[model samples]
Every structure is written in structure tokens, then in C-alpha cells.
Target: MEASEIFENEDFLWRLVRHLPENSDRNRFSLVCQRFRRALLPFRTKFLFNCERYETGDKVIYLQFDPEKPEVEVTPIEWTGLLPMLQACAQTFPTIVSLSIMGLWSGSSSLPTNGLSSVLLHPRFAHLSSLKISFFKAGVDDNFVRLISTACCNLTYLNLRHCCPRLSDQALHSLAGGCTRLQFLKLRGHDRGPNTISDFGIERLLSSCTRLTDLRLCVGFNQVTGWGVRAGHALTCVVMENLNHLESNALSQGLQGKRLKRLSLHGAARLGEIERLVVERCAAEVVEELNLSGRMELKDGGLERIARECRRLRVLELRGVHGVTEEGWKALARHAEALEDLDVRDCYFFREDCLRALRENCQNLRHLLISSYFFLQQRSLETFCNARPSVTVKVYHREKDYVVDERVGLSGRPLGSRLGRRPTLYKDPVRCYKVRRFGYPWFEFLPFELVSLGIV
Candidate 1:
């Protein structure tokens, strides 16, 4: 067989180096065939090797450099270590569109001063549309922002979360100027300067980016509310109106029906009287994604109004909020049957009754994130699951204290296992959050000597 013929054969290529322990083994295999060589290209784009498994079976790799021993074992993708691979990937996968730098494996303490510049300045990124960067503390200097704006002219989607002290109104202005064709812009929990994105700044961006469909504005700021609740501030009322005016202008200019689909105002606690703002300018029918996190000032009626108006809402995130009761959830369930994702985390007074109501009405519910303090009404949960077999619940453990069930006389699981039982995958949020490094025990709180309740 010709060497090129072997490399081109897709069927046998994966099997060739499938059992090879080392990633380097594939390089040697590639020389054997052209198909193998082509196969190696994809692997280079995404590396699956674990650092721990370098010597043994199924090793979990660590991307980040850790000095102090961590509480639990972690498999984080270190961005710096994978720079060479990323460059190769960029070269090989020039047409690659979406890029998400997420998880512990894909983050850096500081923005890659030179590395990022290359990517943004490269002609490759100019054609790209979507980019997501999170958990990085980088000074988004003027030069860096300019570089991005100059390169990412065609970008339509952008998400920058926890990338603080770098982004400012100047940066946003640059992006607005360059990415005139932007469709989605998410600035989550990022600290921009005072008046960085004021009414004028917002008007500038919104008017320019007529194609924007989704916008998320979350800014963390200290404020002494008249009511004494210290919550973060979001886009000002003036800015929101400016946005509305900009949208209206865009519609007048050329865009039809205002293509704006989703608008998120996360962690804007200081923005009092959200209801009036929503009622006054925001076209509830067009807005699909509404995120109100840690905004204690918002009342139940405000939420009710939103449900009544925003009939197209599909994703609603209400995290760390108050004043929303069971009735509010019920109201949303009744109105927004299209709601697929509902996050009610850290709402102190949020009751189990709301969950039951959600199960009964929101048939389209797919993703529900609740706080640890929130408990699933066992009967309601079972009934809901029975009714909607596809629903997956992701509950974050907040409460450790438990009381014995009055009827069953025991807590958690029932007295004994059923005839045919299955192993449940229960994760410990406490331990998971505490884990600093790898080699940590999976079940830290469980008694090692406890006998199994299974019918073994």
C-alpha cells in the first residue's frame, strides 16, 4: 500500500493510533499514511491527553501550573501551555468560526499580551464572527482594544466575562466602529469606568450596530441605595432609552421590525424601578433573553408585567433576586410556556411551590438551576419527571442539614432499595467547589466503612 493511500483511508486511520499511549505516537503513525496525517490535524486542534496519564492508564491532564497542593484534583486546560497548539490550530482550521475560551483549562491570569494581539491582528479573525473570553484579569489597554477592533471588523457575536480593568467605553466604541455588523454583545460582570458607557456611548454603539440582536450588560458597582441594599448597577435608564432610540433609528434607517432578540441586565441591583424602564421603552415582544441577577429592587409586579408583555421570552435568568414569590413564578409559567431555561438561584424566599408550579405549567422547561438552599419537592419532582421525561434538573447543593422524613422515618433515600436499582450519580457541590487540585477524594463526606444499601 502506498503511504499516501494509508493516510487518506479514514476508516482504518483512527484505529491505527487509537491504542497508542502517547500523543507523540500519532506523529510516528502519520508518517505511515497520508490519511493518518490528515487525521492528526483534527487532534492537534483539540488535545485530549492527560498529564497524570503520561505514565499510566487514562491520565487526567492539568493545563494550569499549580504550586500549592490543591484540595481536590482538577483537569484545567492551561492556555499558555497550549499556545503552540492553538497557533497550529488557527493555521490548520482557518475557517473555524466559534471560539470559546472556557473552563479552568482555557484561561490565563492575564490576557496574552502578544499571543492575543496576533490572533486579533491576524486576517483569520477578521472573517470570524463569534468569540468568548472569561475568567481573565487583563488590562484591556487602548492598543489591545484597537488591535481587536481593527481585526475583528466582521464579528457579529462577542462575550467578555470577568475580563476586567481592560475594557472601557473607548474599547466598546472601537468595537462598535469596527464590528458594525455585530448581532450579539455580552459584557458580563465587567467593571467599566464611570460614564464609560453612558447614554451617548450606548447610543453610539446601538446606532452603529444596526444588526445587533442580543445584548447583555452586567456591571458590578457599589451603591448605597435609598433602601440600604447594596447591589450592582447596570445600564442606566438614560442608556436604555438611548438604546431604544438607537433601535428605532436603525429601524427607520433600514433594519426591519428591530431584529433585537435578547437583552440581559445582570446583577444591576442599584437600577431601581426596573418595571417602569421595561414598560416605557423596551419592546417586550422582541426581547427574548432577560437576565436580572442580584437586583433586589425589582418587585413581583415588574416580573408579572414582563411575562405579560414579553411573550417571546425563551430564556429567563433570575439569580440572587428577591421580591419574586411563588405567585410570580406561577405568573411566568402561565405566560411564558416557551421558557426553556429558568435560573432562580440565591433567591432567599423562593419556595418549593414555585418549582411545583413550574413542573405543572412549563412543559418546555429543559434547564432549571436552583440554589442549594432550594429543595425539590420529592413528590412534585417525581411527578414532573414522569410527565416530562426529557427534563434534566441541575441542583446546586446549598443545604446540608436534613430532617428525617416523617412518613419514611429516614432522610434522603427510602428505607431499602427497590427490586431493580440503579446507581445514581450524586455529586458533592461542597467538595467540588473546594477542590483546589487533582487527587482529591470523590466522596469526602461519606463514611469509608459504610456498608452498601444495594441488594448485592
Candidate 2:
């Protein structure tokens, strides 16, 4: 068969396009011909629209290729044009299952809520399973939530971030009544708003959304004292930030019997006796990732309890926690055999003996981030680098100055001199070969360099 004939076949094109992993690649492939575009249309399921305002007050809208990565194609549009764009998207991508719209600015112009509602409530989006609306200045309220609940009956994932100031407990009540099949929900409030959704709304939502597995509430939900979360029986992942003592205790008490896999309690600075209660009651076993960053009341006893209990822990973040001593770290190294990623940044009490203990015991450890507030001897760092060359050690000194030491070769030599600069113990211990490759030609470029670098 001729090459042109093979390329013209729609079935062949559809098979190839379906296997293309990334949306960017599929989009590029569709540009080949009309036949390729038609073949790729069935698999196009996601639509992303972002409108952001820079410091200079210029508003730009664009489509984001990947949500996890920062790659965008800017298409500037007026505030009034948002409705038409959404309407066009609904008409063009009738089979889209996931939709994300971000208006990340506090502009003087009000949002066209009527137009937005018309497009969202359109029959073309009846099967939409995921919807994310973020950072709108105004117009999102209980009525809008009710409209979404009434329209998107199949929605399983909903994320609202800094978008709803007028949203209150009544919105939650509406969602609970209409969106009973929701599995994941994230509500991040604006910093300036009053606490609109309280425990009553949370309790109602959890009780109604029986299949909810992952729930995250970040700033602005100050009224949520953790009592509302106790109703979630199927929750496996939970992230709550900037919680007070009462909230932490309530959350710990609520999560007593649930088997969570990932839990992060960021900025729970006042978790004193509640820290132990959290470990014993909820996160004793089965939890894989735990982040207790900025919990000032965490002590050696709490550390010991976590090490002994959470044997399945793979990722541990203890940033800004200074109460743990060498004894607690030793206990952690002895017990946490499955530990792979550990971040002890801003921990001033971390010592050389703890590093040695971790280097000797943690076989699966691959990433270690420590602060340079208390310097570890160069000899100890070199020893650690040589022994566990697979592990990438990052010593964070300040916001801008940090060292990343990655494994160089089978010899396990630290890539310090690769940067053509001397390695200093406190200032710069080692530089990554990935960063060095851009400016230097002496270092041989390896295809696997990025994977080995482990840049977070």
C-alpha cells in the first residue's frame, strides 16, 4: 500500500490517536488533515479555559495544555467575550466530560452569570463528570450552585477555589440534595470573605454525598470545627490547612475509624495533646502519605508514635517542626523501612547522627530535603551521598540559594564540581547535573539525567 493511502485511512488514524497519551500530542496530530481531526474528536474529553490578570491590569484568556504543568497558550479576550467563548466550547466539544474555567482576577467588571448559567445548563454538558471554577470576583452564589446541581447530575468531581463569596451553607445544602453521587470535592475560600460555610453545611454535604473519598478545605472555612467531617465513612484522603486546636481535635476525633491513605494537616501549629490523639485514633496504619508541617507542638514522643505506628508511610513532611531530637529521628529510621520521600525543611534540630541513621536504615529512601539552619558536616553528607547515591539530597539555605545533590554514576559521586564551582558545606554542597548541562559542555548529556535528578 502507498504511504498516502495508509495515512488517509480513518480507522488507522483513530487507533493511533487514541493511544497518544498527551492532549498536546493529540492536538498536534489533529492538525495533519480533516480526517485526523474527525478521528481525534471522539477522544477529546477535557476543556480548560483560563483568564488571568497580571500586575499591569491586562486580562488574558488561554487554554492550558496540562493542569499539572505550567504550559499555556495566551489568547487575550475581553471580559464580555467569556460567555461567547464558553458557548462556542459547548457547541464544539459536545462530548467533553471535564471542564475547567479560571478567572484569576478581581476585576471591576462583574461576571455574566446569566450567560454562564445558560452555557453550563445546556444539554450538551449533561454528562459532564468534573467541573472546576476558580477565582471569580463575583456572581457565584447559592442559586448558581443549585443550578449546577440540577444540571450536572453526573458530576463526580467539583473544585471551587476563591470563586464564591456569596456561597454559603445553603449552597452546600443544595449540592447535598441534588449532587448525591459526588466523590471528590474541594472548596477553597477567598482570604477576604467571611466564613460562609460552617459545620452545618459540611455535615449536610458529607451525609448526602455518601461516595465522597477525597475532601480538601483550604483557608476561609474558619467555621469548620471538624465535627462535620465525621460523617464521611468512605474518605481516604483529606487535606485541611491553617486549622486551630479545636478544629484539629475535632478532625482527629472524627477520623478515628476511617482508613485514610493520604492526610495533610498544614499549619496546625497548636496541636499539643491532640497530636498524639491524631496518631493513635486515625493515622496508625494504612496511611501512605502524611504531612504535618508547621505543627509547633509536635515533640519527640509524637515523632516516636508516628514512626512506630505508620509502618506503611512512604512520604513524610515535617517542615517547620523543631521539637524532634536525634533520639526521635533514630526511632523513625529504625521503624520507617518503607519511607521513600522525607522533607525536614526548616527543622533546626536535625543532626548528623540522624542523617547517618537514615542513611543506614531507610533502604527505599529516594528524596531528602533538609534546612541549612544547622549545618551537617561535609564528611557526613559525602558519606550519605556515597552510600545512598539513589537518594537526592537538597539542602535549602534561603529562598533562592539551595543545593541539589543527585547521583552521578555507578561510583555514587556527588555532582558538586560539575557546576565548575567549589562545593561549600553551608552555602552549596552540590549542584544537579541537569541544571549544569544547560550552561556547561564538559558534562556528557545522558537521556536518563532528568529521571535521576528527581527534581520534585
Candidate 3:
């Protein structure tokens, strides 16, 4: 066969595009020719529409893989032009499974009275399985959510952020009644909203979405006491952050007996009895990742209980927790054999004994993050480094506002080795380097980026 004939074969091109790993590579491949672009259309599943208002006009830059051409367009349109843009996208990508729309609100200008109804009520988006809407200054309310539930009945994942305070339990009820296939849901309300979604709404949604496995309620939802989460029998991961009215008993009741694999309770200040209840009931053996950061009531007793019960725990974050002492470290070192990543930054009580315990017992540990407040002697840090040459040790010096890697000495070489010369110091005292571990300095707890990347 001729070379052109082989290249023009649609079946071969489709097979080739399927093997491309990254979206960038596939996009570049599609740009090769119109035939390649046509072959790539069926595989295009994700679309991102980001609208930004400039002094010139309102610019809409959307990532759409049009079979006619692979080039993206930057069009200037009015605020009302959003509906037309979405309509064009739906017609172009009929097989789209995931969609993201950001920056919908155009400054102080009010949205149309119908809200997103004109954009989301289209029949072409019936196949969409995942939807994300964020950064709306206004207009998104219970009516908008109800439209989503009605339009996207097959949606398995939904994320809503910074919506209006008027979005009450009625929206959740609508979602429960319409989208029963939901498996992942994230709701982050505006910072200055009345408590719109209380335990009642949460219970209704959990009971209706029987397949839900991951749920995150962040920043708002102050009225939620976490008691309604018990209805989700299939839940494997739960993140509840900044919920001020979260009661210990309700949270404990919700968590008990569920086979959770990951749990994060950030800013839950009143975890008095819930600490023991969590370790004993929910996280005994199945939980692998746990973040209890900023829990002032968590003491050595809670730590010891965690070490004893959660034997399979791999990632543990205890940042800003000061109540733990040397005794807690000893218990963790003795039992947490599967521990690989540990963050204890800002723990003023962390000392030399704690370092010794970790260095001697945590054989599987690969990443250790700590704050410089405890100020362990340089000799002790060097000893720990020499003992665990494979481990990545990061110390955040709050005073200098820099990070130092204990694994590398001042000479930028492995700590145990000397290059036969005095170490040279740089002119700048502040040195910063990115930690490559899964969950590290950038994210004090679980890395939410994994969710966006579809890895978790």
C-alpha cells in the first residue's frame, strides 16, 4: 500500500490515537491533518470553558476538540453569549463525558433571570457523566442546581463552589430526586452564606445516592453536624473541613462501621471523645490515609489509639497538633509499620526522642516533614539523616521562611559524604525546593489534585 493510503486509513488512525497517553500528545497528533482530527473526535471526552472579562470585551476561551480543525478560538462576546458558546460545544462534542465551566459571573452585572437553564437544559449534554461549576460571583442558586439535576440525569460526579447563599436544602432534594447515579459530590459554599445545607439535606442526598463513595463538604455547611453521612453505606472516602458546628457524637455515629479508606477532618476543634471513637470504630484496620490536622483536643491518648488500631495506615498528618509528646511517638514507631508519609509541622512538643523513635522504628517511612520550632540539635538531625539515607526529610524554618533538606548537607551533597572541601554558602539565605512526594509541603494533607487528574 502507498504511504498516503496507510496514513489515511481511519481505523489505523483511531487505534493510534487511543494509545496516546496524554491529552497534549493526542491534540498534537490530531493537528497533523484533517483525517487525524476526524479520527480523534470520538475519543475527546473532556471540555473546559473558561470565560474572562477584559477591558476590551468579554473573552471566552474554550478547550474544544473540533473535528473540522484542532485550533482553539478566543472569541469576544457579551455575558449573554454564554448560552450560544455552550450550545456550540454540545453540538461539536456530542460524546463529551466531563465538562468544566468557570468564571461565569461578569463582574457586577447580573445574570439572566433564567440563570443556567438556557445553557444546561440542552439535550446534547445527556451523556455528560461529570460536571464542575465554580467561581460564580452570583446567580447560581437552588434553581440552577435543580436545572443540573434535571438536565444531567446520568451525572456520576458533580462539583459546585461559591454559589449563592439562597441555595438551600431544596437543591439537594432536587439532586437526590433526579440524579440517582451520583458517586462523587463536592459542595463548597460561599464564605458569607447562611447555613443553607444542614443535616436534613445531607441525609436526604446520602440516602438517595446509594452509590456515593466520596463526599467533601468544605468551608460552608456550618449547620451540618456530620450525622447524616451514616446513610451512605458505600462511602470509602470523606472530607469535612471547617464545619464549626460538627458535633463529636454525630461524627462518630456517622463514621462507625463504614469501611473508609481515606478520612480528613480539618478544623474540627471539638474532637474530644470522637478521637477515640474514630480510631476504634471507623479506622481500625481499613483506613490507609488520615488527616486530623488542627485538632487541638487530640492528645497522646488519641495518637496511641491510632497507632494501635490503624496498622495499615500509610499517610498521617498531624500538623498544628501540640498535645502529642514523646510517648505518642514511641507508640506510633512501635506499631505503625506501614507508615510512609508523616507530617508533624508546627508540633512544638516534637523533640529529639521523637526523631529517634521514627528513625529507629519506621522502616517503611520515605517522607518526613517537620517544622523548625522544636529545634532539634544539628548533630541529631545529621544522625537521623545518616541512618535513613533513602528518606526525604524536610524542615520548614518559620523564622527564615525557607525549607532545608536534611538528606543533603550545606554542600548540596548527601549528608554523610564530604567532597573534601568546606561547604560553600550561597548569598541568599532562603532556599526552596519542591517536595515530589504524593502529599507533602504544598498540600499539608491529601492532595486534591489527584481527583482532578482522575488518579484517585
Candidate 4:
């Protein structure tokens, strides 16, 4: 049956919406649904009502969306049957775990906060495992934070990105004290002026709430040095930036001997901070995925250490670290036995030999991103690709710097001349040669040949 025919059933529709990704534009989906049903879905799981500036690529995306008149107006008088719907949902689905509401903008005017706040702060949402609120620029301060913490005792994931107003150390302390089960806490994209988040706040939050496995703080720190804070032993993923030597060392010391799976310090450019040293110390054996994309100070020795220590690494990103030579690149055969995804895009010292070795040893390696050094010749590219039937390799091109369309390598050889026709390296034929002859992006260019002939 056709997809359009299958979606006619309401059962399928509700199931689809429930499984639809959280980041999907529900507002747009609701507008489309207006054609099918006169009103929105009223799913009770997710509802978005806002009048912010909307953009889809180069054009505005909302049909009945006027900047002055957003469709769903949330006022005390004009509840638009929403309050009744919520009451119905609460009666039906006793323990709905996820809820989110994005409120007013800086310039855009708002509705009555009391009604929405009352519904959100109710006992119905006490068992909520996840709560994500953003852009509530009205007045979601200490009281709101305090209320959420007190009510949602078992909340594992709480993300208040870009929604802090009058949120102070008091609110953070209250949250840490109250919600002991919070595992994923992200409080980034906050307003800089009113928000007072420093080492003290972070330390207070982490020390008390010891169950966190994924913690991300994109705010600036003050007062307390790095050693003062203690991220719990259960933490598996951490994305930290601009951490000094002391803080990095302290964090490493705390997380030592733990089963840390993902460690991302992609933006730290400090050479003298001993941050690389911290990496060497912390993720010795257990870490499965690591991202040190732009740390140029990491030398061949450090790369060797990672290869030696992290034997079970599944994913490794060394995008801009150019210090590693063929020795370090080839050393992956000895260690990193289970390496599946390897990104060495801007590592200028990378060669084709590394690919040959990785193919022979690491049979499970599925994804690879190599530098431009190997893209000079089609034979070289094909040789590496042909060896690994299960791998997807994409050669990096400087999209901005290099003017020519990077369909094919700029070898300057005439497209016809190589296969014997004419002597001209112009646009159409060269691009065809690139897309067909030399595989671009997906090395297996055509599907028929890709499977039947085994990854051509």
C-alpha cells in the first residue's frame, strides 16, 4: 500500500507523531494538519505556540502565521479549549513523562504566564522524566526553577537552554538538592547579564546531584578553580570548552577509572594548559569515542599514547592535528582494534598506507574521512576504497578556498585524454568523470554496481 493511503488511519497517525523526533517542527506539522482536521492534533505530549520570527532557508515558513497574529493565542479568557484538553489528557494518560513549552521573544509580546505556569507546576507532571523549556523571556526565574525541582523529583533530563531569567545560585542549589535523580543537565545559551553561573554554582550542582552521566556547561566560570568541582563517577559524556590546566586536571582526577564512553573537548586551543595531559590520564582504557578535533598541540607521542591506551576505541576524530606522521597513523593496527569511524580530515601528514593497514587489521572499520593529500590521483583513491568493501570514505575539500567545483580532483589531465577522446579538462565531462569514474562522497557511486559488483 502507498504511504499516503496508510496514513489515513488515526492509529498510525498518533503512533507516527509519538515517535517523531523531538526536534521536528511540530508547529508546521500542526498547520498542515489543519487541512486534514479543522484544528491541531491536541496530542498532549508536545505543543508549541509561539510568534517568533520564522525562517526556512531563504523564505518564511508559516502559512497562517502573521508576526502580529500567531494562531494559538494563550490568554486567560481565550484558552482555545486547551485547558480542557489538558484536563482530559491528565485523566487519560496518568503519567505523561515528557513536556515542553517555548514562550515569548525579546521583541515579541506575550500572553498571561500565570495560567501556563499553573498547569506546568501542577502535580500531574510530577513524574516527568524530561522537561525542556526555552525562550520563556517573560519571567521564568528562581521561582519557576524552584517549583520544577520540588515537583519533578525523578527528572533525569532537564534542559533550560536560553531560558534563564533571574536564575541564580539559589535556584541551582534548590534543583541539585531536590532532583537527585537528574542524569542529563544542560543549562547553556543563558542570558549573560542576569545569570550568575560560576564554579561555585557548578560545584554546588554537581557535588549534590551525583547521578549525572551527561553534563554540559557552556557558561563562563569564576572564583572556584577547576579542582573545586566534582562531576560524579557515573558520567559517561562531557562536552567542556576553554577549561584551564587546573580544571582539566581536576576533572580528570575525579573521572579516573570510570567507564567514560564519550569525551569531547573539540574547542580547547590552549597549548600550555596540560589539557592534552589530562586526556592522556583520564581516557586510558574505557573511553570508546573521543573528539580532539582542533587541538593542534597534540603531537605524535600523544597520538601514540591514544593508540596504545585506547585499544577498544570505536570512534576517533583527529581533524586538525597535523603533528602525527605515518608512524602514528599506522599505529592504529596495533591498538584501536575495534575502530569503526576515523576522521583525520585536516591531518596533513596522513597517507594512503594508513588506509591499507587499517583495512588489513581493523576489518570492522566502516567510516573514514581522509585529507586532500590522497585525493590527487583517482588510482590512489580507488586502491584504498576497493580494499574495504564495508567502508565509506569521503575526501576532504576546501569548499571556500578552492574555487573549482570539487567534483573531481584538479589533476589538470583532460577527461577525454585519459580514456582517449579529446584534450580538454573542462566542466561537464570532468564532473561526470568525478561522479561516475572517481566516486564522490559515497565511494560506491551507483547503486546497481555498488551491491551487485560489491562496492565499485
Cα deviation of 119, candidate 1, in Å: 4.8
| Candidate 4 regions with alpha-carbon error over 4 angstroms | 1-15, 18-92, 100-116, 134-143, 162-168, 190-195, 219-225, 228-231, 242-248, 256-259, 269-280, 371-376, 395-456
Candidate of highest TM-score:
2
Give the distance in Å from residue 48's predicted Cα in candidate 1 to where it truly belongs: 9.1
Q: After superposition, how far is residue 241 of candidate 3 from its true place, in Å?
A: 1.1
* lDDT per residue as tens, model 4, 1-456: 333333344443343242444454756555434432322344222222211112111111122221121122121112344555444444444455776544435513232245555665666666777777655555466777787888788899888766654566887788888888989987654324355555567667888888888876544323224443455666787766434332555555555555678776665545443334435546666778888777767776777677677777899888887767778788765577888999887886776676667777887788877655533354555565556656766654542111122222223332213343221122343223222222332222321221111111
Return the candidate ranking by lDDT, descending. 3, 2, 4, 1
- Model 2's C-alpha root-mean-square deviation from the true structure amounts to 8.4
Per-residue lDDT of model 3, residues 1-456, tens digit only: 333443455444453232333444545555543543343233222211222122223344434333432222223234445555556555655455666666544632344226356756677667678887666666367877888888899999998766545668998999999999999998887667774788889889999999999999888777888888889899999999878888888888888788899898988558675467567658578989998888888888778888878889999999998778878877888889999999998887888888899999999999988875424655667688778877777666442222333343333332212343222222222233223332332312221111111001
- How many clashes in each structure? 17, 0, 0, 1
Pairs that clash in candidate 2: none
lDDT of 4 at 248: 52
Give the true-structure RMSD of model 4: 9.9
**Against the true structure, candidate 3 has what lDDT?**
0.67
- Indicate the worst ten consecutive residues by lDDT in candidate 1: 223-232
Which residue ranges in model 1 land beyond 4 Å of their true spot? 1-111, 119-126, 188-197, 220-260, 352-356, 371-377, 387-390, 399-456
Tens digits of per-residue lDDT, candidate 2, 260-297, equal: 89888887546566456556767567889998888778
lDDT of each: 0.50, 0.66, 0.67, 0.55
Model 3, TM vs. native: 0.73
Q: Which candidate, 2 or 3, would have the higher lDDT against the true structure?
A: 3
Q: Against the true structure, what is each candidate's TM-score? A: 0.59, 0.74, 0.73, 0.65
Q: Residues 79-178, candidate 1, lDDT per residue (tens digit)? A: 5445544454355434445555553523564444566677556554456667676665553454665676687777777776655344456766787788
